[model samples]
Target: MVIKGLKHDAVAYNTMIGGFCRIGEVGKAEEFFREMGLSGVESSCVTFEHLISGYCQIGDVDSALLLYKDMCRKGLRPEGLTVDVVIRGLCGEKRVSEALEFLGVAMRNHEIAPKRKSYEFLIKGLCQEGRTEEALKLQAEMVGKGFEPNSEIYSAFIDANTKQGNDELAGMLKKEMAETQMPKKQE
Candidate 1:
């Protein structure tokens, strides 16, 4: 599109960025964003979301967060989707503490409360890392925020505890699941 000079606009650049993200080509997406910058195309929140989501999908959370900070520094308000990607990346990397800290920032500074999946991912990651206490605390926080804990998250906690020889915590989680109507499988 840039080579052909068909029409350069934020929307067009965002569309291209979205396509690159879908294909897990975040590096290319970054290049496209730079091209958009050089071409005098002003970006929007959605533009940053697309690139951030792509980088997160590819396990490039550092890059995604860097882009996120850049968006903030440039005075572009981040949308919920951008926060979601950050949570996904942090949780996927087993960085639950960082994810939780960022979640707090999102809620306090940006008025973007995390979605249920965000909590789920954090809890799941903590559980996988054998941080049962942190996982339980996060689960409590999720429920306090009116978000229901999903079955998969509970199962991850249970399974992780079981694998770590923390039979007490595993049994406790199992009983909790039975009481809360969480699934027995799906771990």
Candidate 2:
């Protein structure tokens, strides 16, 4: 393609980066991402999205967070998948506070709406960390946005509230779970 007078543009670079990321070759993806910049091709949000996803895939949530910050610094508003990946990654690492902070910031400044799965991860992570109050608040927000809480979330709430001796809330959660006809997660 180079010999055919076609320089590697943003699209080509992004494709290569995305390919590497999908295959879990995040290091190579990063190399190409940097080289893409050195080659005078402005990286798009998709470029960052690919690399960030790669880092997340490899359990390098910190690295992904750095790239996400960089993307924000460059005035790029990440798409929904990118937001989901970052939130899921942070929650995977038990960094629920940071995930909540990121979500809060995005919603406050950019109105970024995460997918239901992202909310589920964040809510479950918070519950696991014994931050059930915050999790419940976040769950309310998610529900307010039209996301139906799944069985896992209801189970999480029931388990956490029961463990914490919040019997009223736990009983209410169980009743709600029954009303929804969602099966409870077996202990």
Which candidate achieves the best lDDT against the true structure?
2
Q: In candidate 2, what are the lDDT values of residues 56-119, reduced to their tens digit?
A: 9999998998998899999998888888888998988888898988888877777888789888
> RMSD for each model, in Å, please?
4.0, 4.2
- The sequence of per-residue lDDT tens digits that candidate 1 reaches over residues 123-144 is 8888878888888888888889
C-alpha lDDT of residue 126 in model 1? 84
Give the number of colliding residue pairs in candidate 2. 0
- Give candidate 2 regions above 4 Å deviation: 3-5, 165-172, 182-187
lDDT of each: 0.85, 0.89
TM for candidate 1 is 0.85
Q: What does the lDDT read for residue 143 in candidate 2? A: 94
Consecutive 10-residue window with the lowest summed lDDT within model 2: 176-185
- Poorest stretch of ten by lDDT in candidate 1: 178-187
